[model samples]
Target: MGARIERQKNILDYTLAALLRRKRKNAVLVLVYTLIVFLLASVVFFSRSLQREAADLLQGAPEMIVQRQVAGRHELIPLAYLEKIKKIRGVQAARGRLWGYYYDPVVGANYTLLVPESREVAPGTMAVGEGLARLRLSAVGDDIEFRTHDGSLKELKIARIFPAELGLVSSDLVLVAEEDFRGLFGMPRELVTDLAVQVRNPKELPTIAYKIAEALPDTRQILREEILRTYDAVFNWRGGILIAILSGSVLAFILLAWDKASGMSMEERREIGVLKAIGWETADVIQMKCWEGLAISLTAFLPGVLLAYAHVALTSAGLFEPVLKGWAVLYPHFSIKPYLDVSQVAALFFLAVVPYTVATIIPSWRAAIVDPDAVMR
Candidate 1:
């Protein structure tokens, strides 16, 4: 066993020396390969992290959301619908939700206005997200002005700011008292933006949604699962777009590997010939070449993945952020949580390293089988 281990070590040493001998050529190949892996891995890492964040944040969200549509556009629902929804058999609770978009002209950004159900937002104070606070240059106890729907300017003090964890969802969120929300939006007291429904039993969510639809034909009922699926699909679409952008890199790498396999330079052929002429068996020559390829691939793979992790999770994927997360004046400045799964890494490996390894095999064999004396001449 020790002998086998020692022999493998020797082969690895030879691989290292061989790779260093062609450092200039191999360095370019390794750098390009690393960049490709970095781009691909960044997309995977960012998408997966966003998906996990959505799941965690939405865990306690309402089981279903009901909205009213008038003439194919969303309209406020009357409070009367809440009573009807509450009377449904499987429904444990139903409440009217007061929320709307508040477009701030000064900042040129839109903010989500919501009234928290559990707490009473003071009439003259509101809680804002960290992003909104930063944009407004306001903090707790600072006053900000908003142009209301009625062409009136309303001033409110900042009660608090949401923590950073909520940044992704609340980057432009504004929470205020129900009366304040209605006043800012010029909405009548009898109406609300939508309805949040909680069912007594989760298993009957579908049936409850169906019954609500039956009761309120003009209303659209959105199941929580459906909302979650929508988010998942959206992130997946964005991730696909990122992959499409990097597909060029992928193609270039494939071409590089193919060129290496199909056309071995005279120097490479001569090196293989010399190794075989010096009593290195065909198997030994192949092993050495395999090690050389692996050394390059692995050296590129590790740093590529690490850099991608830092890019997505720390720096928020600087260049790709607007592409993947979308561009908005009030876009979230939050970084994704660092999450590196073994399966994802493994998938990347199979996608990248395996192909190069396979491409090297036949060419290495072709070189190894040549007549050493004739090749030398």
Candidate 2:
């Protein structure tokens, strides 16, 4: 065992020396390899982080949401629908929800208006999201005006500003009283944006949703799991698009790898020839090449992953944030909690490190199998 370990140590030392001998060439290779790894890691990390954020935010959401459709477009659901939903056997509770969108021309952005069910907002006061507060430069007790549906302006005092940590979901949100919501949108009291439903048993969510659909044919039931799945699909689709766009860079790296595998420089050939001539076996030469490949791969991959983590978890992936997060005027500012999956990193390692190592070994093995005199000539 000691002999084998010592042999490997010597081979690794030689590998490092050989790499340093061709520092310019290996440095360029490492730079390109690191760049490709960085791009791929950025996409993966950003997409996964967004998916996690969506799931975490939706954890406290209603089990099911019922929306009314008119001519294939969403319309205000009548409070009457709440009664119908409550009548469903598996439904534990059902209530009408008031919400809508308002475009603020001053900021050139849209804000979400909602009526809180668990808390109260005074009729003449409202709570605004951090993004809105920042945009309007407004503070608590400050009045902001909204033009009602009848082209009349209504002003409400800012009761509070939501915490910045909730910006992922609450950015551009405005929480108002039910009366205020109805008056501002000119909606009748008998109608609400939708119905939020809770099921008695979590496992019966699907059955409850089907029953709700049967009871209200004009209404669509959205399950919490379905919402989560939609978010996952959207993030995955966006990540796939980004990877596709960066495919050219990946191909370039592969070509560079292929070139390294297919041919060796005259100096490299002579070096290997000399090693074999000096009694080094073919296996030893191949092992040394493997060590060289591993050194370069580690040199590239470690920094790439570290940089990607910082970019996504600390800086919010500023490079690819817009593409992955979607277009929005009031973009939320929040940090993505760092998440690492061993399987994902392992897969990336195999995809990147293993192939290059194998490629390096194959060429060295091919050259090592030949007679030293002939190789030198």
Top-scoring candidate (TM-score): 2
Best model number under lDDT:
2
Estimate, for each residue in 172-198, the C-alpha lDDT of model 1 and write its tens digit.
Answer: 989899878888888989998999999
Q: Which stretches of candidate 2 lie over 4 Å from their true place?
A: 373-377
lDDT of 2 by residue, 1-377 (tens): 99999999999999998889978988999999998888899899889989988999899899899999999999899998888788778889999898889999998999999999965898999999999999999999999999999999999999999999999888899999988898998999899899999988999998988888898999998999999999999999999999999999899899997787557878787888999988899999999999988998889999888888888888889999888989888877777876787887888888788888888888888888888776556
Evaluate all candidate structures by whole-model CA lDDT and list the values in order: 0.87, 0.89
TM-score of each: 0.93, 0.96
Against the hidden true structure, what lDDT does model 1 obtain? 0.87
